[model samples]
Target: MIEFDHVSKHYPGGNEALTNLSLEIRHGELLVLAGHSGAGKSTLLKLIAALEAPTAGRVLVNGLDVGRMRRSQVPYLRRSLGLVMQEHRLLMDRTVFDNVMLPLTISSQPPSDAAKRVRVALERVGLAEFENAMPITLSGGEQQRVAIARAIVNRPSILIADEPTAHLDPAYAREIAALFRSFHAAGVTLILATHDDTLYSPYGARRVELAHGKLLS
Candidate 1:
């Protein structure tokens, strides 16, 4: 459902983050992006999400060219995507319910319906009882679960997670990995960028590695 055609991304001062990186991610497929820091994995994800424009080439999501889409059109395009960053990005001052409700609120979903969806998402992440709790009071693993819940609350078709298990312990990392596996099995197109090979390698998903901004053969 996504394609990168000769895509290259360059930041300020002429630093190239990705170089001619091309790949296709099919619907309902679970893909793993494995690489060290500065290997272009995060840049690739941002390109797909339209958060960063490609300096050259094109990025297409569900047949629509993201690189060519209008700024106003981005929100509509992103409605189908669920993004989880390395940082939890939770609102520490807000309750879990409110944080998970943000996406739906942005979309102007009805309150009654949004609440039900948020409850389901929290349950999926095994945080059903913490809906009224504050983020600061939760454990690291619990906070990550809250982030996951917030991402998927809208029931997006594609899920992209960047370094999701980076700060968690081995057990919590495995828990998060297993949760992602369940989502994959349920037919969500998943692309996870992680430096931890052991966390996802056992899933036998198609693996793509990058080195110095280029895909490794």
Candidate 2:
């Protein structure tokens, strides 16, 4: 379980992203964050992964305080999470397999074990045959899939995506949506922030709207 207890995030230069917001997300819930740009949707997601700290209040994940975790603990916290941020951030020079394997390279897992896991992740994303392909060669939607594969290579229990279906055509968007659904069906805690009504409105199990950093509903 994750809880945001009266959380407020104030950036440098007096910009407040969130204001005394409190929310609770149970495990394995498909929660969608709905809002216009700058509504603090991304900020809310960042707090979960501890990419940003709250100026006031606490964010607790399974009884561990996110805001107060040490640097060494942050990596462990993130290992339990799969993140697909807006940017693909894939290395243009790297092969698809290499991109997915990057996460495991930091661990004590052996090369053979890591390689098998990478292959499994690629297979799940339906890109097993494209492991040798370069990111520069794939289409936008395929590139997004690669990013998703990289995120899940760690076998994270919780998945967070920011605008997962953005910038894709209708068919491609639908495909990606279905992919996310499969993950949810497999019992991964899915938290997605999207402005696309097709995704957040009729798609997610629960929808929470935000406006100017406050929950609207």
lDDT of each: 0.92, 0.90
For 40-127, candidate 2 gives per-residue lDDT tens digits of 9999999999999889999998899999999889989988899998888999999999999988997667899999999999999899
TM, every model = 0.98, 0.96
Each model's number of backbone clashes? Answer: 0, 0
- Per-residue lDDT tens digits of candidate 1, residues 1-217? 9999999988999899999988999999888998889999999999888999999999999999999999999998887799999999999999999999999999999999999999999999999999999999999999999999988998889999999999999999999999998999898999999988676678767889999899995
Question: Number of the top candidate by TM-score?
Answer: 1
Candidate 1 residues lying further than 4 Å off, grouped into runs, are none
> Which pairs clash inside model 1?
none
lDDT of 1: 0.92
Among all windows of ten consecutive residues in candidate 1, which has the lowest summed lDDT? 196-205
Task: Identify the leading candidate in terms of lDDT.
Answer: 1
